[model samples]
Structure formats: C-alpha cells, structure tokens
Target: MSSSASDVAPRRPLLAGRGLLWEAVILAVGVGLFFLFPYDLGFLSRILIMIVFVLSLDLVLGYAGVATLGQAAMYGTGAYAAGLIAIHVTASPLLGLAAGAVAGAGIAFVSGLVLMRAHGLTLLMLSIAVAQVLQEVANKARPLTGGADGLRGIRMDPILGLWEFDFIGRAGYWYVLTVLILVLLFLKVVVNSPLGLSARGIQESPERMRAIGTPVYWRLVWIYTIAGGIAGVAGALAAQVTALVSLEVFNFDHSAEALIMLVLGGAGRLYGAVVGVAIFMLVEHVAAAVDPFNWLFLIGALVLAVVFFVPAGLLGLPKALTGLVRR
Candidate 1:
C-alpha cells in the first residue's frame, strides 16, 4: 500500500510539469494576439486583467476549496488603494501596484480572521457582507473615493520611467501581459510546491489533514491573503492603464463573472483561469455585438452546457471527450 501510494504521488509532479508547459503555450498565444489583433488591444488587455482576478479566485475557491463570491471585495480594495496613491502620493506605477497589493492582503488578512471560521452558506454570506460594507463605505466617503462619480485623475508614470503610455494602448497591453505571465509562473510554482500540495490535501479531506496535525485554519488564511494580493495586482493594473477607478470594481457582478470564468475553464487547474477568461470574454464580445438585448442568454446557455457536459471545465474537455469515445 505504501509503495502504491508513493507511485501515485509521483504522477502529480508529472501533471505539474504538463501544466507549466500548457501555460507556456498559452503565453505564446497571448503574445501572438498583440500582432494579430492590434485594434483589439484595449479589450484584450481587459481580458488579461480579468485573467489575473480569476486566477486569484482559483487560488482560494479552486485550490483551497473555499467557496466565495466576494473576491471583488479584495479587487476593489486594491483598485482604490492604488488609485488614491497615484493621485495623492506619486505616479510611479510600481509603487501604486505595491500599495494595492499591500492594501488587498491587509484587508483579506483582517477579514479572514473572522470569515475563515465559517463554512458553507454562512461563509459565502459573510464574504458578500464584507464586500457590501466596503462598497457602502466607498459610496459614503465622497471626499476620498469620489463616490458615485468614480475616482478619476489617476496619472501613472511610464514603465520603469521609460516606456510612455501611448494612446494606442500597446504599452499597457505588453505591461499587463508581462505581469500576468509572471503571476502565472509564480502561481504555477506555488501550486506545485509542498505548500500547494498541502492545500490540496486539506481540500480533499480537511478532517484527515487536521488529524495529522495540519493547521488548517491558518493555512486557509494564508492562501486567502495571498490570493487577495494577486487580485489587488489585477485591480492596480486596471487603475493605471485606464486611469480611472470606479465603485463597480467592487460590485457583486464582478465576482460572479469571475466565478463563471473559472468554472468555464476548470477550477483548481491554473491554466483554466486564463483559458476561461479568454473564451468567456470572446463569446461575450461577439454575442453582445450580435444581439445587444439578450447576450446574457447566450452566456447562460454556454454555462449550462459546460456544467452539464464538461463539468471539469474547458481544460478537462479533451479528457472528457476521450472517455466518451472509450465508452
């Protein structure tokens, strides 16, 4: 039994290697898009930003097995933090990103202390409440957050103080793409690491993990905090590239959309986040253009199809098809 278990464990490392290879291929495709669709850079950049946000969600909900619908809480917190720093402190893009990351992690850490204690629907409700409270606070702090009008006048310095942000968005595209790749690479390492494996173990059988002396609660808090920082990086990128921060960043829709994207691609698998965002956004763009009134109906249909058929997500489609053929 021990030998069999050890043999099975090695397969995980092999899968990890394959996952990294897939990420590289995805990165190549993303780079090719810049030259292939220069006119759609703005829309593509938004997808890249969403990729980061969805990836962060994958970390908590997918890997840690924490069901949440309030990731926007951290996302909006990061956006506002970075935007305010840029407007009041300095225009350095890096600094703003750092501020956003720190602010996001801080909020997650504080909230996780309480929120992590709950489970099932209770946990989900508390998460939503945190986001709602933050939203209300932002709405009331008219002087600081810009309230309903949105936060504006954000000026970001050039990348490394060299590459200027042109009107065409080429710089922003490359910048966001680079950041996404780095984050992806970092997370790839993370999910394959011992820490990541432990998270997965906890997800599969928390009682067993606890029985083995794992500090499940603290681990969850750590991952949640890290995931929040990643989400913050996404929000900061949006603030800098677009030069505007809005309350909509904290909206429940943002979280819902992210969850959909993650499910569409296949959660717990890092590559799913990127692929899901790309597919969903492309469908949304084309569907909305085709029928402005009922684009969501198309999206809903797609989601239902995925849930019923390719339940593992788009990433698992090939295997799903293979199994079907074998049967």
Candidate 2:
C-alpha cells in the first residue's frame, strides 16, 4: 500500500527545525558583523550586496544545475533598469527595486527560451554572448546610459520617506540586511517546495525526469527567471545605495567573481553563498591592500588551495578536517 500524504507531512517538522537553526545562525552572524565592523560598514554593505548576488547565482547554478557564466546579464540589466527608473520615473527606492527585478526576470524569460535548450560549451558560450551583447548595447546607447562616463543623477528618496541614507551607511546596511534576510527566507521555502524537488530531479537526471513526464525545460526557465529577479534585487540595492550606476556593472568580472564565491562557499547549500562572499571579499580586500601589484596571485593561490584540499568548498571544511583527523 502507498503511504498517504499525511504520513509524509510529519517529517517536514524535523526539516523545518533544522531550517530554524540555520536561520538563527544567520541572524547571529549578521548581528555580530554589525558590531564587529562598525568602522567599515560601507565595505561591509558592499559584501552584503554581493552576498545577495551570489545567493541568486547559487539558486541557478547550484540548485537548478544551470551552468551559466552570464548571470551578470541579469544583474546589469537590473542595475540599469533601476537607475533609469530612479532618474526618469520615480525617486522611490522601493519602486526602483521592483522595476529592476521585473526587468531581470523579463530578460531572463526571453533569453531562457533559447538558452535553456543548449548544453555544455555551447550553453556557456551563448550565455557569455548574451552578456557581451547587452554590454555593447549599453555602450552604444551613450545618451541614455551615459556611455563610458557611467549613469549618474540617480537620486533616491529617503527609504519609505523616513530613514535617510547617511554618510556612515548605517541605514543602507540595515536596509540591505533586512532584504537579504527576507530573500533568504523566501528561498528556503522555495528550495524545499515540490518545484524545487523537481528541479533537483532534473539536475540529477534530466532524461529520467523527462521519462517520468516532467517538463524539464520549463522548470529550468522558471528557476532561471526567479534567479534573475533575485540578482536584479542585488543590482537595485547597489544602485540605490551608491546613487550611481556604471557600465562596470555589466562587466564579466562580476559574473566570474560571483561564480567563484559560490564555489568557494560550497554550491548547493544556501549558506555557502553567504560564507563564500564573506571570505572572498575579505581576502580580496586584504590581499589587494597588502600586495596591490600582484593581488591576483594571492587570490589564485587561495582558490587553488580550496580546489585541491576542500573540494566541497569552505562549508565542507569541517567534514573534510574531520575525515583527515580520522585518517
């Protein structure tokens, strides 16, 4: 006899308990960082924003198993969309953020029509091409995008017309932290949902999933759209806080760095995104300060060490170490 749905429902409480534990850990870490880096809140805020970006990428490449290097396409599109909205339409930060997310999702949905069909090297190249095309279009629209000089005159109203964005960045930090927490919570629900399980199934074996009557292609496109929206939120946050948007937002480096951070923290685990961003950004900041002439070498060495030693990424370090000790 097959088990009823009610029989399996009881197991969710245990999973929810674990989710609560992780949420508490995240809250503790965020609170600790607020106190630990009072003097460098601006830099810390940037890390928080990147954490959002990396988290979005984790959703696509890690959970959805969509091998992509053009996530910056969605990111940059959101940035530009938010910046333009702020400049031309409304001074409302929230509205700009919404616009950014919509733009990202819309673009992703359109692109995924073609992108989700390809695989391997072809998929990677096509993703890269999309970003390049967007970059070129932004470049050519000199009047609209401000060309190489970057998008300026982006003024945002005080958040909710109450808390003013101050020089110390306390408001921005708290604002971003709140948004990050909310997004993380939403994603926790998503990754545990039936759709998320289907995504995992597709990732593990697309052929098998298809044979089981699953719509693998549409599932990917949906996840990709959702991921793009999340990435757009990150870009919107950057634009709102910085009060400027630049062409560099579309740069390939952003996409590459995000992927590295995801891998470093351990893809497939949501917390890995946060941990990876924190570690990578901290390392990059210190290394660049200490050896501005050749900081890349230090970064490269660190990545290599992680790859060779902690194949599961930094989140797996504890297990890796435990195994070594056992040996």
Candidate 3:
C-alpha cells in the first residue's frame, strides 16, 4: 500500500467510532427530551422532522454547492402524496412514507435536469419558479389537494400495526425520532461514500472535477434527488403526526427558515443540521413567547450575529475560538 493509504487505514476505526459516539449522543439527547418535555411532544416531533429536512438541504447546498430555494416543493409533494395515499389507498404510515420519498425524488430528478444547467441568479430564480408553479397548481387543484383549505381526511394507521399513535402523541414521538436517527445514520454513510466525496470535489471545483472525468451534473442530480427523498420523509412525518396536509406545506417560509437554520448550525457538518434546528426552534419558541409580535427582530438579529461574528457557524465556533486563542 502507498504510505498515505497505509497511514489512513489505521485511522478508519477511530473515525467510525467517533461517528458512533456522535450518534449515541443524539439518541441520548432525544430520549431525554422525550421524557422532559412530555407535554410538548408534538413540538419536539416538529423539530425532528425539520432536522431531517435541513439535513437534506445540507447535502445539496453545503456539500454539493447547489443553491436552491425550491426544496419545499419536494417536501410538499411528498406530504400531499402521503396524505392522498392514506385517504384513498391505505392508512399505513410506512407505505405513506414510501410514497412521499418517491414523489420527492421524482420531482427532484425531473426538475434537477433543467435547474442544474443554470448558475448564479438564474439557478435561484429557476428553482423558485419551480416551487411557485407547484404551489399554484396545488392551490388550483381544489378537489384533489383541497386548494386553500389544505388536504384533510388523512388517517394514518398505527406504525407497523403494533404501536398505536394515541391522543398524547407518545407513539408518534417515538416514531419520528426513530426515523430521524435512521435518516441521520443513512446520511452519515452516504456522506462518507464515493458519491459524496465526488460531490464535494464538484462543489470545490466543478470544472476541475469534469476535467478529471467526473460527471458533475449527474452527481448533482443524484445528490439533489437523495436530498429531496429525505425532505419528503420529513414532509410525510409532518402530515402523519398532524393528521393534516395543507398548501402551507409548500410555503416559502418553510424553505427559508430551514436554510437559515442550516446556515446557523454550520452547513457542511451533519451534526450542524441537528444543532441548528434545535437552537433555532428553541430560540424562536422563547422569543415568540416573550415578544409575540416582534420575534422576527430577534431571529434576524441572531442570524446577523452569527453571520458576522461566527461565519463558520455555531458548530465551528469551538475551532474558531481555538484559533483565536492560539493566535
């Protein structure tokens, strides 16, 4: 083996164990929150769902260097698809999640073909346009999507026909948490795989990557599709837990807020997504409760502070501090 390869092989075990350590921390924190905030199980579930959504965005925007604002389009598509499945086809949650994933991936793969061709402002505009068109269609399809009122009549069966989703949401909380952990683990695997490394290379320099024989566009498309599928899972979770699917699922704020959280937590790191969601949601909750009408001011301030003072994001703060201390 080459000296570099030989040196790297021994560290693989350490890295893998580190990954497991982080995941264990997440699991412990999730369980603690579950018991501590039993009254806010529903809210906690929302945070978990959004964590999944932001993680998807991290894969595309942070790792793949894809600038986008239409992610909610895939998210809403999955939600509506899942809702329709539950009402017309079956009440099975598992099947509904699958439908959501497929719907999100389908939209992402189709739209990514065109969106990937554009760059800078044009790409952003095109992405926004795609989402706008979908939102309009959902609004107009009154009979199918319930238009402005939202998709109602969704009834999710117990998870695996065993754990009943009861009134207080104990079963639902556990279900969403399990999904979040699985998604996190899956993403950890993907981000460390060849495809993910190729994506990073493309992000660093698409021209260089292409010159080296990487199919840059195709790599992006695959990454975007994967992200969309994960976002769709988040959407499906939202629909199942709330027992309602609405046009608001396609709301621009959802995408914007998710992006903001991702940025705040630090985009490139997987744990950043989780931390960002938790901190953003927690602060927003407290701020809104305290200010009610002017909570946006606090949120804006927080984002600005992070951007100016901690460009590497909250997760990178430790490194930043260490650098300063050493300096």
Candidate 4:
C-alpha cells in the first residue's frame, strides 16, 4: 500500500528456452490454422480478440494480485476510440487501432492512479464503478457515439492498402491473429522481465515484498495500467470486426465474459487465455446455434464440469490426456 511497494518490479517467468520453444510452436500452429481454415474465419477472429482480452485479465488478476470486474471499461475505451477515429479522423483501420490503443492506455493510466489504491472487494467495486461510469458516458454521448443506437458509419480502408476486411472475414481473421501474436509476444517479454518477477513476488506475499523494500502498490498500479492497455487493444479488435461501437462495449457482461474466459482457461498460465477463449467461443457458437434461448445453462454446466474435472482449464486437458496415455 506504501509508495515503496510500487517501486518493486514484477517477477519474470522461470523457464526461458523451453518456454520460448513451446510458444513458438503454438504460435506457428495458430498461424497455420488461421491460413488453412476454410469455413470459419469470423469465428477464429473473434476467438483471437477474446484471447487478448483474457490475457489482459490474467496480467491483473492472475499475475499482479489484483481482482477486478471492470476490465470492460478499458475495452470500451479502446472500442470507442477506434470507432471515433474511423468516423472522424481517418478510414484507415490501422490508424483507428493505434488511436484506440492510445486512448485505452491513457484511460488506464489515469484510472490506475485511483483504482490501484484499493485491494480486495474495494478494488472489485472500483473496477465495476469505472465500467459503469463508462457505460453511462457512452449512453449519454448520443451525438458522438450515436447513443444506444450505436456508432455505425465506419468504413475502413484496406489493411496496409492491401487486404480489405471482407464479409468473409478472411483478412480480419489474419489481422486479429497477427495482433494476438504480437500481444502475446509482448506479454511474454514483460512477464519474463524484472518487473514481472516483482509482480509475482507481490502476488505471493505483498507484505513480504514490502518488507523486503519492494514497492508493492506501485507495481500493482503499473501492471494494472499495462493490462488496461492490452484490454483496450482487445476492444479495438472487436470494434474493427463489428464495425460499430455501442453501450454494450462497456457492459457488465463484457467484463464478466472476460473473467470467465480467464478463469476457464486457467490462471497464471499465458496459453490458458487462448485456450479459454477458444473453448468458450466454440461452445457459445455451437450451443447458441442449437438453442439460442438457453445456451447459458449449457455453458454454466460445462463451466461446472471444468471446475470439477479440469480445474487447470482446457489447455491442461491435453497434458491430462497425455498422462492418462502414459499410465
């Protein structure tokens, strides 16, 4: 809680070479699937966007010992920024994306000054409050955001003047995939850096970290800001794909979904973010197609099953299967 706590950096990942190899392999597989898939680029693109959101959550809730339910605040900030940029500044989606990131990060930094001060339920409450305020702002900004009707009129230029976002979503899929890859790489570097190690130390024992001359509070604030920036990127991705920004961008459900995806995938493990998003999106797609009115019940049941059977998440399912085979 002291200023000194914020001075300490986060802890880095323990594994170096083997971890990099695994990450490279996974990235290659993900890229290959994006290119090779024939029927469902939209679905995959959505998954990748959600993966970024989930990873951002992991950074705060899993790595930095902050519990928040208002991540959608940043996500919405990014989405609105992208939409605003597209509509007002330029039609270039990449420019809109950059604008969104800047807006998201700026909001995070400002919000972090206050939100990062509290812990436990207070932290959660502040987060929720932040999102609610953003939602209210979006609802009231009918002129700029089009209010509840949503901001529509965004026409993006071809990505890099080459690939256009199509109805088929092929280019969009690749774009999201590329961003996800870059975000993951950035997160890897961050979690392996000195700052990340301090985060881990704080997570394990904030009191101890503070006692040992670590700046626990500021470290948490810094991590929260970073995560918020990432969440904003996720929002920008969603805005790009949907081509609109609305009050729903700051909705409670958006934040809750990000949390569910993070928990479903597994906390602390980076790949768990992707795995959680993939499974969550796939289940939603299949289940909603089958029963639109009651898909949530099925999802709840599946989440319960995961809690009981594969607590580590869908990512751990493969390792569990391998263990069974070995046995």
lDDT of 3 by residue, 33-142 (tens): 98999999999999999999999999998889888988898999999989999999999999999999999999999999999888889988888888889999999999
Model 1 lDDT tens row, 1-327:
676666543344434555567768877998999999999999999999999999999999889899998999999999999999999999999899899899889889999998889999999999998999999999999999999999999988898999888888999999999999988888988898888998899789989999999999999999999999999999999999899999898999999999999999999999899889999999999999999999999899998999999999999999999999999
lDDT of 4 by residue, 1-327 (tens): 998779875764555666677568767877787668757887777788889988999998778867789999999999999988888889887888887778888888888899888888898899899999988988898898999999898878889999998998888887887888889888988887888888888889999999999877777778888888898899998898878788888988888888888778887778888778878888899999999999999889878887888887877788888988999
Error of 3 at 88 (Å): 0.7
Candidate 1 has which clashing residue pairs, if any?
none
The lDDT for every candidate, in the order shown, is 0.92, 0.88, 0.90, 0.85
lDDT of 3 at 254: 88
lDDT of 2 by residue, 45-137 (tens): 899999999999998888878889899999899999999999999998889989989998988889988999999899889988888898889
The candidate with the higher lDDT, 1 or 3, is 1
> Highest TM-score: which candidate?
3
TM-score of 3: 0.96
Return the lDDT, model 1, position 206.
Answer: 89
In terms of TM-score, how similar is model 2 to the real structure? 0.95
Clash totals in order: 0, 0, 0, 20
